[model samples]
Target chain A: MNPFIDIRNDFPILKQQVYGKPLVYLDNAATTQKPTTVIDALCNYYRQDNANVHRGVHALSERATVNYERTRDDLVGLIHANNRREIVFVRGATEAINLVAQSWGNANVAAGDEIIISAMEHHSNIVPWQWLCERTGATLKIAPMNARGELLMDQFDAMLHARTRLVAVVHQSNALGTINPVAEIIQKSHAVGAKVLLDGAQALAHMAVDVQALDVDFYVTSAHKMYGPTGVGMLYAKEALLEAMPPYQGGGDMIRTVSFERSEYNDLPYKFEAGTPNIAGVIGFGAALRYLQSLGMDAIAKHEQSLLAYATDKAESTGYIRLIGTAKNKASVLSFAVNGVHPHDLGTILDRDGVAIRAGHHCAMPVMKFFGVPATARASFAVYNTKDDVDTLFVAIEQAYAMFS
Target chain B: MFDLRSLYQEVIVDHSKSPRHFGKLDPCTHQADGHNPLCGDQLHVYLHIKNGCIDDLSFEGDGCAISVASASIMSETLKGKTLGEFEALFDRFQQMVTAPVDQPVADDGMGKLTVLAGVREFPSRVKCAILCWHTLKSAMHADSGVAKTE
Candidate 1:
């Protein structure tokens, strides 16, 4: 019996039918389906505690503010962060990376400075640094990945020098499911006096991500990936760095006192957080994290690994499906292609059987270019997915292969 | 609205596997690159236009079955047609694919292009099916530049 299969009932969306068939959602890397707890929390917040946070003196506003700030504190424990002030809330991982790029990156990166990123970074992580390079005249150096989609650590070490200011890399590749050697990257980067920022958007959901243990300077991730509300995520920075860096955007809540001339910025996290926050979303995000904790990360990781291995083996056994991103160490993603068919063709075919999967570059074009394929169909596992879902995927793949070939 | 079999009919698969007018033209006159950045589908439409008549037209790119087949079917139907006729074809094709899924397409001058009528079911794939026509439109009027389906 599968250890994790029993929890599927907790997620009501998984029990529904799609296209006159049972829905087998394997697109976790894109975004996860929410459990009823998260949904109910979001509903309850808007229904009961509906008010603007931080500004209004009303009881609803106080409740909203308390709940909103609670997510930041929850994130501190979730990522093993030291203090609540170290955690900063933003729209999502994309905006968190941009915050680092604009606030910290703008101040540090110079014309001759180097920002080292891996080939497997999402567009969110890649583009912000690329834009920073364009603005600051710094060079964006790429640490190449091997054929199996694993990063070359030796090459990454070689790339780092005194000129390297930051080593921004993904903790796990969304496209390939390759869990990177972030710990080593951080140690080596720090040896050369370069700060490390890990894009933990995928990693946060799949595995146990402890920012303190990793000792990385910055760790960015989103909530929607972890079965939370969309448009709410966290950036974990060391308090010293948070104190040193400038505010990303100039607005309310980020200031101590505003004036015509100048304004003193707020504390560590609030300095980064600007304007009216996503109050209900933040409340929902806290509930999501709590839900994940209740399930236990170790159990979720094991269940997902089993699913990944089972799906990978079954997909290869079909003989028509060619698996991409075959790293020795990987996560819940299984990206593959049919023998003579495009990924989208396979996707449309699978959709007929109500097996939802993501077929694209997965927002990692550089990884696609490295693999020399336009796109790959990915079936990513979540807490609620089971072996039956994997079986359904293979059955659909064989049918699609026959139809396309 | 998205009927799976109707969208991936036998014709789309055949054209995608063995795309007609698949390679680049040697003496290419009017050319424009088309890109569906969201899908990572890129095609370069090559036209051999002379005296308002499409002498020869072909495309070279990598895309989904829908896109590649649409380009193939489009090239096959558009070889001997004049510029005015190509415009009419573009209009009707766009109308057919972009039309609401519930509405039926009136058979104007689309010809075999109606094979692509299924694209209307999948709103996202509509960009893929019509990318070649947009490139063809750019090749007709503009000298040389990329055409984007935004």
Candidate 2:
């Protein structure tokens, strides 16, 4: 397959029209658009295999159970987890992190125990640990970053002490597009017997992730950001941790038996997934993974890298456009602010021209405060994005500058 | 190159570049701050009311063209109106922006605010356009003075 030429055909939404112009969607960091295969999988599941799993005595139930379990196997393959039992489904990355924080952090972390996180973490990663620290009397320590948005390795090393219980870091920053050294982070945390959880919400779709090789204790990702359905995500934890931690919720599927005297819990992954799951969404997520696998992550990464380089060159040459998030190792995101033009106004003008870029903190307010700006105009790329899209952005930015100047 | 004329019309750009009353009122009686955190647009509104009528009004903040222009025109229109008239105008403004129309024009007394009648076309930006008005209303009803900072 010609990586760039062929893959754009799979996503039907790429052909959409916004304000009478062809849509140039560069908001993949927010949520990805679905491909035909994922949409078809959703429609097929509801049309043919729509039934409650595990308990019903009907054929549809049996089919649903098989397909749902197949999704678990797909995730196991995708992340290269030790076993299928390590994968637990949740609402999204936020809920998955909350589950670990509330269940595991509450149980293990004690007063004065240190939980380390980086400055680059999204609010989802930061707020949960803050809540846990407040509830458990644990202290939250931050691993600071340098001026260029790169994590300060020396600072991270200094922050890790014997009291450090867990180190949570983002695999790729949603706002800055920085590809963090999670393999190094896992190695360092493990050296001090601290567990590591990498927020793969932005990383999973853009890079190749192998949980087994990285030896990460826990990893989380959201489906909506991966061209799959929303309200469905995966959490990969070490099998031992899953067995030791208490279940996050209690309901029908997570129980083995219940009586007035005592109640027995269900097995591994089901213990974490407490209710009738988002069956259709899970099926679609599996299909999205299959679609990605077919395209090959290495090819997708290469295509996106080229697009990023092209965009960076275009924005730099345009003059008066100050690009933010210029980390050494970054993904295909171009965040910038034009001279003398507010990001909100630039976003408005671009939207009128059928170019969709996110204009705000990108849900990483701490990063915005770090940069000393209230907001930025971010144009993030995906599998379907092309050089023409970047050209459109450059043209719109030039017009914005001309209007203000 | 893309054309900025459709979205940043001359009137809209004019208001954004040279916004009227784009500063704070010292020792102001009524002041409120408005924000649209989603887009990071902010407006600080200040009004001096005397005898239930607007004696003076001013604004200060950072926002898109539509938002700044809306605030500028809103402040200009609100300059001599009574408190009751301001409330009525707020309702009319809300209706004009939120309601569906085919090529709606800003025929209301508020000049250059008519430029923002184009804002009704972009549903997401309606919040940006109306943020200043929301701040004004909150300022009008505050016990001391409400500041809606986000």
Candidate 3:
């Protein structure tokens, strides 16, 4: 029996119809739909254990704190972090990267220092460091990529030098679905004494990530990208790194003692997480992680790989479809353009057929410019997706071409 | 579901495939570029004004059916109008596309320009259909900067 059977039933939203047909949710890169278990966890926390955590002395407070803190422990295993102390919760991956840029980036980078990123990075990874460089007189460097959307490691190696303080890159591109050679990237950056940060926003749900094995200095991912709720994400830094960096925001929970003359920050993880945490979001995240653990990451990865291979084969067989991001190695994302049909038109036609796909730059405008296209229609798959969904996508794309041509 | 036929009529599709007045005006006194950053739809509108009237009007760029068709219909409709006439027609065309789907626009002598009225149902494509008009407004004022539909 297939271990991942009845997965669609677990997500109540998947059962609903869009327009007049069943919804084909191929926009996983934008955000994953929550399963019933994850949704119930949020409702359950609010229904039974709703209270302010860390400060309340009542039983609800203690219960809420336990559930919220449990998520950190769950994440430690999810990413194979050293311990719970290394997990810092923030708004989302964007906010997590900003936290690192403001706290650690501000503390370490100085005038004339250089930070390196790649051509394929999302705006979230690129903009914060750009702002940091402009503020501190540091220089930002770019590593070029080849036609296949893979980073040219030789050029990246030549770019690194003694002044390179940090190297941030995307683990898996949301636009291209290319699983970058992050392991090689981390090793190369560390060889030059530069810390590496991987934005795993697109990789977290598709594969197994082990921070300890990859030995990346810092990692960031959002809960919504996976099966969890929005408004919550995690940043995994080395325990010592988290201990050394100052608090990102000053608020109730991030402080130990306050005074007009002097103030002391809280401990690791807590110091970076300010104000009242997203107690319900954390509870839901714990449920999400538990759901992943039950499914087995290896099984999930294998199933998604098969789905991607099948979809790619079908898409290539179509003579008129121009496939973008023909990376030899990719995940479950298929971005394409029909002959004589614009992406926006394709998106509207597909929506009429109840095939929901992302039709834009996928928040990675630089990648679009690199590929020399205005926009692309991206259909990304999830664990619940099947081969039938890809069939529907092919049919919808044919309709778009017929109507436009 | 949204009706694709209403939006992508035969006229709109035909004009998109073979746009009218689709080229540059080499010595036009007024010219401006228009861009919709959301979809990367770009167009350049050029106008030759003579004796307080538009003598020659042309456009060249890349856009979708709605935008390209709207520009094609626009160039054919407003090519020979006076400056005052062009301004009044611009207001009427804008009103026609933005008005509610159920409430029909006043038949203000648009001729083929009524094809774009289908966009009233698609609020997002309103920017696409009006990109050229905005660029035309800028060209009339002799603005060199690009007109962006944000």
Candidate 4:
């Protein structure tokens, strides 16, 4: 019996039809369908406990602050961070990365310093380091990946040196659906005395991540990818490192006190969270984490592994279709190209059939260029997605093939 | 279900698969690059204008069916047209695709290009169908920058 049976009911949006066909949303890598609990959390916060956090003299403020900080506590457990102070909420992974780049990057990196990243990194991870390099005259290095989309550890090892200050790479390739060997990457970077930051935007949604076990210096993820609200994500840093790094922004809650001569900053997480945060989104994200925990990440991973295997086998049977990413260790995402159809055209046909998939560069143009394709159509699965969704995806692929070829 | 036929007409598919004038034109009077970053569709439009008339033109690029077909059809239609005539045709083609779907587009002057009016139904794809024409317009004006359909 399928354990995920009737799980689709939890996501109210899944019941809707698109173009008169049942909506088979396969774009989980892009963003997930929010569960009813997450939606209710959003509504409940606004309907009852809507107030500014961290500065509440009133009852509503205390309730709002309690709920908002509860997410930080949930995140500490979600990623196995050492403490609540280690988890700072930002807008999303992009903002989280930018915060690290500006705060820690400005303080630590300087001329002749090296920052290493993988070729499969999304533009968010790449651009910030480039900006850092441009600002401080630091040199940026790219760790190569093979045709199969797995990172070349030997090449990466060779690139690392004492000059390599930071090694930032995606925990999972959103474009290729490859789960990189992050543990090995971390250990190797540490041997060379380089700090590592994992772009956990895709990883947290599909797998169990323990930052303490990984011993990663920094980790960032978006809540939306994990069936939570957008514009709210968390950054996990070691307490010592976050303490030493300069604050990312300055405003109301981030500071302890201000005077004409100087202003004192707040402690740990609050120091980084400048200005008004996404109070409701954070509350919704807390609910999202609870929802995922209720299902158990291990069970979810096991279910998604089987689904990915099923989808891979089905895609392989199509002799003309080419799977873009064939890493030995991959999950959730199935990026592919039909023999004659451009990804954009295939995407359009699939949408007409109500099988929504992500097509094009997927914000990883370097990966596309490496694979020698202009773009690829990606069908990523989530917990609510079933084998039936995989079947619908293949049917749409055939329809696109028939129309284009 | 929305019929794929409305979007992917037989001619559009044919042109996309076997695009006409699908290469660069050397010794061209003017040219401009075109790119749609959203889908990664990119193309170069080249024109050889003599006495203010398009003497020869060609394009080379990778794009979706709507874009490749639109460009292929445009290449064939504008072969002997003057600069002024190209502008008028561009206006008519632009109007046909951008106008309200309920409003009927006149087919009298559009010829084969009328097939692209189907894009009015898919707003996201309207940019794909117009990328090459925008590039061509840039080429006509001798603009050196890449024309983008955002």
Candidate 5:
């Protein structure tokens, strides 16, 4: 019996049905279904402590401020960052990357400098570096990956040179389920005197990350991908780096003393968080962290590993199905192609059976181009997913294949 | 509730399986590429027109079953029709698919094309059904010769 079977009951949305069938949600990579704890935290914050944070001196403001700041403290422990001062909350991983690109990139990156990214990065990781390169005349480089979606470490090592400013890559590929060797990547980058930034949007949900242990310069991720509410995520940087980097956006909360002549930036996190942050969303994110802590990340990782193994075996058992991203080390994602059936059509047919899977490039168009497929059906797992969910997924795949054939 | 049979009708499945007029028209009078950026579905609609009337209408590219079937049925229907009739039918087809599921759409003369009316239930697939029509419209208007449904 699966130890995590009863954990499915915590998510109210999972109990519902679609088209008179039980909703077998396999789209965890896109976004996770929030547990009741997260939902209640969001509701309770609005119902009782609905006040702006950090500015007001009243009791309600203090309550809201403490709860919002508590999430930052929680995140510091979650990722094993240096401290709360190293954690700066942003909209999501996209904004966190933009913050690093604009504040840190503009300040440090010069003309003819190099920024290296990998082939399997999502558009969010790719576009910001492109914009920074365009702004600063820096050359953008890409480290290629093999057919199995594993990054070429030798090629990556060769690309790192004296002028390489930042090496930003995905910690875990959303399109393929490849988990990159970020620790070794960071070590190589640091050897070349280049700061490393990891887009952990897909990684944090599946595995435990330690920013200090990785010795990464910057790490960014989204809350929604980790069973929390949207519009709240964090960027983790070394305190000295964030201290030196200019403020991302100039606004009320980010400034200490704003006058006609000159204004001083607030502190580490507040300097990056310009506008009023997502208050309730942060509280909900805290609850999500607590929920994950209770379940333990190691257990969740093991559960998802076995689930991925089971799903991969089931996918291969079907003669017509071909699994994409056959990397030796992978995580929660299982992207695959069905013979003679387009992914979008497969998605529709699967939806009829209440089996939801992502069917597209998964925001990694370059990866799709590399694989030479327009799109593949991706069924990513989470803690709540079971072996039964994997079985249902293959059944839905059989239905789709039957229809197309 | 969307019935799978209603959405993927026998006519649609047959057409998608072996699409009619499924190639480029060499020395074509007009052509336009249609792209659904959301799902990466792409197809080119080609037309051979003579005196504002279609001599041949063909399409080539890749898409899902709904889109391919819709394109096939559309190419078969609009073979000899004039540009004016094509526009009129386009309007009717748009109205049929965009209308509420419960509302009745007047058949007028849309025979095989009406099979796509089930797309109204699946909002996400509506673009898949109409991308070819929009591409044909762009081909008619002679814009940049590329259509995108974002």
Candidate 6:
């Protein structure tokens, strides 16, 4: 079955009109449109199974509790994590990374210790480590990326030393579309006795992820980018590490027992997940994962690869257009800039034609600086996207070039 | 009524490419800097005010087309006007950009400024189109000892 026709019927928003034209959304890197299943799951949870879990002894609480834990199990299978204890739900990937940096990083990293990160890291990955470094007197080392936006593995190897305590990198650059060798990175970092955290916010939706195979110490992802609800994310950590790390917040649900003298923390995943969880959002995320599973990740990757190839071909055909992030192993992102037009202007013109592409640093300012350009227009693809979407983008870009010319 | 192409009219592009007063005035009496960190847009406004009247005005900046053109037109609008008159003109300009298209500038001649009316349709860019005017307001206030430009 054609995925476009099958899945386009699931997203009602895709059928709507923008600027008197059908919307061609290419901003999947930023956020994806939700399917009917996920939307229905959200509404059903709120209407039928609304209650506080783990505390209440009522019927609704039991149903809510079962559904919530079921999401943890689903996420375990989705990422191929060893156990459900490894998956800890948080607000989003930003908060998840912050949890690790504040809890694990602050505990492990000391003065003169080093935390290595890549030049392609998002601000979410950069700022947390910087904060940890500033607090702990640890130095933050940057592993630079080559012109193609691929990290130099040799340089990364050189940067790792006895003092290196952690290696944090983005699995796929949100701006550049470069897919890093995360499994190799994990192995290399582990060989040097350093823990590795993969920011998989942009990867989980595009390709298949196997946490056990990658053997990363921590893997973080956001649901909004994976065709689910916003304000919900997951952090997959080794069960041993999750048990060893301190609680991120002092709150109600994270405590096993609270006495006047002292308090004992909850088990592996629950220790990190404090206070009330996003119940509806988690249900929606489970629905999104099931939807992807039904479609199969290999098929989705194949579809996106085709779209990326078409877009790259068409965008390159436009003379004077420079495509940034030409890494050999890339996902479905095309970041480019025209010689004479600013990215902001390009985005404006594209929006006029109902083509939604992100036009800024894309929250990766250091990558922009490394490329020596202020910003670039980014077109990202997903399962619902089609080659016709690429054609629309090409026509719009040509129109933009002609307007400026 | 909502034509996206009109927002990027040829006139706006012309003004952006070759702004009317697009340079720095050295030894100027009043100067101010404005920046939009979101888009990395930066501008420096220099005004030569003598006896409370504008003698010269210029700008130096790197930005997108809308911002560059807006700064250029802002310099042209305030070249020879007195500080008080410039404030009134700025108020009129702000009203023209932010107000509905049907609203008319009561006393200020805003017909020439209507070229910027297209900016109202794009809300995210209104800040870019008005950055120069905001700097000019701050610079004029600084010259009159109302407050520091910092």
Q: Give interface RMSD, every candidate, in order.
A: 2.8, 2.3, 2.0, 1.4, 2.2, 2.4
Residue pairs whose backbone atoms clash in candidate 2: none
Q: Which of the two, 3 or 6, has more TM-score?
A: 3
| DockQ of candidate 4 relative to the true structure | 0.77
Q: Candidate 6: misplaced stretches above 4 Å?
A: A1-3, B101-108, B140-150
lDDT of 6 by residue, B1-150 (tens): 247555778878888778888887977888877876656667888889999899999988777788888888777777788888888877777776677656553534754566787887787787778888877777766754222112
Q: How well is candidate 3 docked (DockQ)?
A: 0.57
* Worst window of 10 by summed lDDT in candidate 4 chain A: A396-405
Q: Between which residue pairs do clashes occur in model 4?
A: none
lDDT of each: 0.89, 0.87, 0.90, 0.92, 0.92, 0.87
The TM-score, computed over Cα atoms with residue i paired to residue i, of candidate 6 is 0.95
DockQ-based CAPRI category assigned to the predicted complex of candidate 2: medium
Q: How far does residue A69 in candidate 1 sit from its true spot (Å)?
A: 2.0
Which segments of model 3 are wrong by more than 4 Å?
A1-5, B142-145
Model 2 quality (TM-score): 0.95
TM-score to true structure, per model:
0.97, 0.95, 0.96, 0.99, 0.98, 0.95
Q: Name the lDDT value of residue A113 in candidate 4.
A: 98
Candidate 4 wrong stretches, greater than 4 Å: none
TM-score of chain A of each: 0.98, 0.98, 0.98, 0.99, 0.99, 0.98
Candidate 4 on B1-150: residue-level lDDT in tens?
Answer: 345787788888888888888798888999999999989989998899999899999999887788899899999999989999999999898898998989988878788998888899998899999999999999888888999997
Model 5, which residues run further than 4 Å from truth? Answer: none
Order the candidates by DockQ, highest first.
4, 5, 1, 3, 2, 6
Instruction: Write model 5 residue lDDT over B43-117, tens digit each, in one string.
Output: 999898998898898999988899999999999999999989998999999899899988887876899998998
* Candidate 3 accuracy as TM-score: 0.96
Worst 10 residues of 6 chain A by lDDT: A1-10
Best by TM-score: 4
